[model samples]
Target: MQPEDLVRDHTIYACVTGSRAFGLATDDSDTDRRGVYVAPTALFWRFDKPPAHVDGPLPEQFSWELERFCELALRANPNILECLHSPLVEHADATGRELLALREAFLSRRAYESFTGYALGQRRKLDADLRTRGAPRWKHAMHLLRLLISARDLLRTGRLTVDVGAEREGLLAVKRGEVPWPR
Candidate 1:
């Protein structure tokens, strides 16, 4: 089946993500959507197998096959873990509900490594931007800080939460470049 067909017919879970899902959206923020699709078992029996992921029958949309999604979640992938925690769920079937129910099974102390590693990578890019362009991408800097904060809190509380909650306004300010980068 085609990629859009897989998303349309086989998608089991989907949700809004990114700034909007983080409760940090501005009037101009894009609505980022993410999802999981369960391709038919029979599809994997073929030589072509199935696409591990598909991007966009809609703009700003992407999705992963069920097994791949679960595999990454188990590995404490920050993006996958955040996708599981997003409160703006757009769709969920029986399979999706089961996947959501397994959210905790997917989180572990390993997040300390995975989340920080991701944040550090982004930090390096921002640092490079600062050195080359004389200013880092403010929005990326804001999100990197948010990721680090989220990781720190998750490590402390043993809970994964995507929304920035009380930090929303401060983070938005940073996104707007109201907060200065370090000296």
Candidate 2:
């Protein structure tokens, strides 16, 4: 079936994500939407299983089938795990709510691996940017710090907290490029 078909007919959960969901949108921030959809249980009977992920008929929109999302989250896929924790949920059905209830199951010491690995990957790009442009992508650096803090807290508390909570102003300062990484 088409990606749009799955999104329209089977979407079990949906949310606004990225900077908007982080409570950190500026006037220029784009709205990023994300979601999970569940194919009818009977769809599995077909010889060809549904695709694990789909991109939009709408710009900047994407989705994963429910089972596929869970599987990837279990494997410590950072993007999939973050999708489960996005604070700006726009829609959720019974199945979707149950999935959210299991968010903790998806968390483990494994995040130290996935989260740090993601940070390292971003750092490389920042390093390259510094070489080419004489500065790191300060915006990406800010988010990396935020993500590291989140991973640290998740490891310490065994809970996922998406909002910056009391760190709002500090993070905003970082986002605004006031907190530069050492050169």
Candidate 3:
């Protein structure tokens, strides 16, 4: 089957992600859509398996095959884990509901490392920008802070929450350059 066919006809779970999912969207932000689709089991018997992911039939949209999603989630992939925790769910089928119910199964002590490593990588990029340009990209800096917050909270609570909740105003200040950095 075609890539779009899997996303369109077999998608089991879908959600709004990125800024909107994090409760940090500005009026100009794009709606980022992510989803999981289950290709028929019969298809795997063939040589050319369905795509592990599809980039888009819609702009800023993407999807993963169900097994691949779960595999990454189990590996403590921060993006996959956060996608599973996204609060702006747009669709969930019976299988999707089952997947959501299994969300907590994806968390572990490993998350601390995963989140920290990703944050460190992003931090390095911002740090490079700061060193050469005299200022970090404030928007990326804001996200790194938010990611750190989420990682701390998740490690503390053993649960993941993708939305920033009460951290919104302060984070927005960082994003908008209203807050002084290195304070």
lDDT tens per residue, model 3, 1-183:
678988999999999999999999999999999999999999999988889999998999999999899899988998899899999999999999999999999998888888888889889888898899988888888888888999999978888989999999999999889888782
**lDDT at position 115, candidate 2:** 85
Overall local distance difference test of candidate 2: 0.82
What TM-scores do the predictions have?
A: 0.97, 0.91, 0.94
Check candidate 1 and list the clashing pairs: none
Model 3: lDDT equals 0.91
Of candidates 3 and 2, the better by TM-score: 3
Q: Judged by TM-score relative to the true structure, which candidate is superior, 1 or 3?
A: 1
lDDT of each: 0.91, 0.82, 0.91
Error of 1 at 13 (Å): 0.3
The best candidate in terms of TM-score: 1
Candidate 3: give the clashing pairs. Answer: none
Deviation in Å, model 2, residue 26 alpha carbon: 1.2
Per model, how many backbone clashes are there? 0, 0, 0
